[model samples]
Target: MKLASYADGSRDGHLVVVSRDLTQAHYATGIATRLQQVLDDWGFLAPQLEDLAVQLNHGKLRHAFAFEPEKCVAPLPRAYGWAVVDVEGSVRREAGQFQGPHQPLRAPAACEPALAVITGDLAAASDAAAALDALRLLTLAVDWRLDGDLIATHCAPLAVTPDELGEAWGGGRLQARLVALHNGAKLDPRDVAAVPGDALARLARLRALRAGQLAGVSLGALELPLAPGDSLRLDLKSADGQHSLFGAIDLDLAPPPALP
Candidate 1:
């Protein structure tokens, strides 16, 4: 199994898992379960994590899972919650084809890890509270390769929802486009709602947001199976509109060098 994991910044940062062997589709679920084990150990929604595995690339035998940050939060009291992450898995194939659809971050040069999240059942308050305790100590958790005799463990925390979302974007090769603004340009709520065309409307909303004239700014991206963290901000008026996007990756939870 040639697993290259990365953060899909699209849907609040979902985890993306890919395999090189087209014949390995049967193992997709198994791989996803193993990843869930990681999340369970780290202290996210244990029961909820069981239901998150999904197939993203059935042809290439690739699978994906996502964790919703908004929904994965703890009930209360124990403010501990999932925030950061670092996933590391083995690369059974060449790096070129691993992230062929997914690109690596500019800074760290390493293979990405797979995505994992909870599905099936809605995470309950009780589960969320339990998860909160786990999320607190996640920063001190250690990563280990699936090695029988020689295990290579890295001292790092498990990847979070947003980080995994970045992986999903790169792994899926999905594109994003601007949608609409909610409350664009608030003229002290005294003036009329500045309603412009989709393009210009966004520009006005952004200005209002910058000038602190609006309560908040709302922008949407087009695509399905959003990973949570997938986002790109473009300076519509800047000299041709320079754009900048932020995402995350998982390189700490790398599988062992040897494969089964």
Candidate 2:
């Protein structure tokens, strides 16, 4: 089932269930209000959301609305545990809020295309197999690695269940290529080999652990420099390389706020 969060003048926007074709949506008002809430009660809430997704996809809902990509915030506006491991292998806490794909970004030095993994409760010292089982959703993300430090992140509009990935997901990593476009031009597609198990293990190893905490993991390799007024699109394709797996994360980088 595909899920998106629409901007609603709140830190955690309104939750909506998106259609399979990415054309329509319906507010998940009665089922669950926030993505984090669902994550916190995955066993009970996900199946309900999945049922809604099915109904929306099949045109069974009467109040469904057009899915607006531009009005979304990060699937999880603020993750329970969001962090990135630097080149030196140190887990740096990326505590800032995540921007939605269409959200204007304060022009950064560069953007790195990546596959982000959002997980459910995971036990510490979990192996790859265990870690893989804990993964719940997958989405596209653009990372800003400033001087090797994680500065900011822009997440795609929708987050898909791992089952949506089909064969692309295996061995605790996304075995697929990430396509990146900069300034309306296609850059080299990056073959992703980022193992979430490795990253999560590191996170558990370095700090005291918590159960049922949701963490967004980014493992990107392609970096493209940018300036204000530049635009970017990051996408992942199906294993057959025919269509987009998660919808493209399209961003129009905006300049930073002026001095007061």
Candidate 3:
């Protein structure tokens, strides 16, 4: 079952259950008003939302409307923490080119699964899976800069979950394709990499994650330099290409005003 937070003219958008095909949606007002609320009480709310999802799939719910990606915000707008775990052995192998001016940051040799703590606000997406059991979505990691200085490692602003990808978590490989674009012109594509499950296991041991805190494990190393207006997109597909995840974020020099 796919879930999303959509704009309803409110600061924290309304929660909605999206159909498998991404065509229709039903407001989850009966379950929760916002996505963060549901995450806060996932133990109780997930089952209820799952039940609503079943009802929508069976055509039992009324008031359903067409779903729109453009009318959506990051699934969790604001999270307490955002950390990306690097896949072991995959990082150095995937660092295709060193585009940044400074020496490329390397994962410490002692750190089994190197982790980076993202500071400031991070863009969220309903499509990317936060936990091992969470629904999986494609995540795009953008190399962002502010006033000509690299501010964050990556900014994932948008993500989409497709129904074709069954709810299968753990013990499998996830292939990722990293593409960099400047003014719509494609840059040299990076080496494709497969994220193994052991990396996630290492992260679970290292981070004492709270209920809704997001853990973004990098599938591979990012070696692209993005300037203002440039963008990075990551497309992940299952081995069979049956299920896929995608996300993109444009670079902005001056950070957006923080929300009150």
Off by over 4 Å in 3: 9-11, 87-164, 167-172, 176-207, 221-234, 240-243, 246-260
Alpha-carbon TM-score of each model against the true structure? 0.16, 0.87, 0.59
**Model 2 root-mean-square deviation:** 2.7
* Deviation in Å, model 2, residue 134 alpha carbon: 1.7
Candidate 2 global CA lDDT score: 0.75
State how far residue 249 of model 1 sits from its true place (Å): 16
After the best TM-score superposition of candidate 2, give how far the Cα of residue 151 lies from its true spot, in angstroms.
3.2
lDDT tens digits, residues 1-260, model 3? 67766766676667888776667788899889876676666668867988887888777877888876656655555555444554443221121111111112222111111122212211232212333344233344433334434334432323333233444223443444444454467766544543323333334443444444544555444444434333333334344444434323333333334689
Query: Worst ten-residue run, lDDT, model 1?
Result: 209-218
List the candidates ranked by lDDT, beginning with the highest: 2, 3, 1
